[model samples]
Target: MDGFYAAYLTGRAGSGLLLFAIRGPTFIGVDGGGVKYDGQIEVVDVGLKCTIVYMIPAGTPNLITGASPPATDQRIPLEFILPKDFWNGQVVGITTPLGPVNARFQKLRDW
Candidate 1:
């Protein structure tokens, strides 16, 4: 199986919405593997409360489920601060080699 996973943090800082996300490729290795190059946030639409990320290929064409080799040792990190009013229900969409995966923001607590 080939996919991706993400870890994110979201919060309200005054009138702004703070967001930080880290994403990477995932796979179940057997006799083959996958490679992920570098990834970047392609778009952030506050109006739609959605973000899109794209992961570039490292030319390896194989999936890596364990220790990443030097060529595929890359991860995607995104940070943003937007209007709080537009981020009530934000979703992050990531495009990987296999396909697309989504992560939703949930309020953890209030400060």
Candidate 2:
């Protein structure tokens, strides 16, 4: 799926933009405008799956399960890709610059 992320720089902080194209293995996430486009990200376990809520610079994260998909490959219809394997009855936490977010398990008919 296509998602949009925007960051603004204030008096002290610099402006930044993150564009993520998550289709296959090679998850393309880029951040620029302030710091050099050379940085890293760390993923932590959140009961259900580990996720890198904070990614610095050109820090890139790959899809946990699938092989790196082609840059131009199309996403599977109605597929919801999660950071980690989640049990049907389990709850998971998602962390970001904003804060921790919670998610509940739900079954989908397809994908």
- Candidate 2: lDDT of 78? 18
Q: Candidate 1's residue-wise lDDT over 1-111, tens digit each?
A: 112322342222111122333233211111112322233332345522223332424553323222233354344433333333323456655443333434354443432
Candidate 1 least-lDDT 10 residues: 24-33
Q: Which ten residues in a row have the lowest lDDT in candidate 2?
A: 5-14
Q: In order, how many clashes per candidate?
A: 6, 2
Give the per-residue lDDT of model 2 (tens digit) for 1-111.
222223221211222344443332323444443222222222336322222232222322232222242344222211123444342545444333333334443333321
Residue 68 of model 1 has an lDDT of 30
Cand. 2 TM to true fold: 0.26
Question: lDDT scores for all predictions?
Answer: 0.32, 0.31
Inter-residue clash pairs, candidate 1: 33-62, 33-63, 34-62, 34-63, 34-64, 35-62
Which prediction has the highest lDDT against the true structure? Answer: 1
* Candidate 2: stretches off by over 4 Å: 1-84
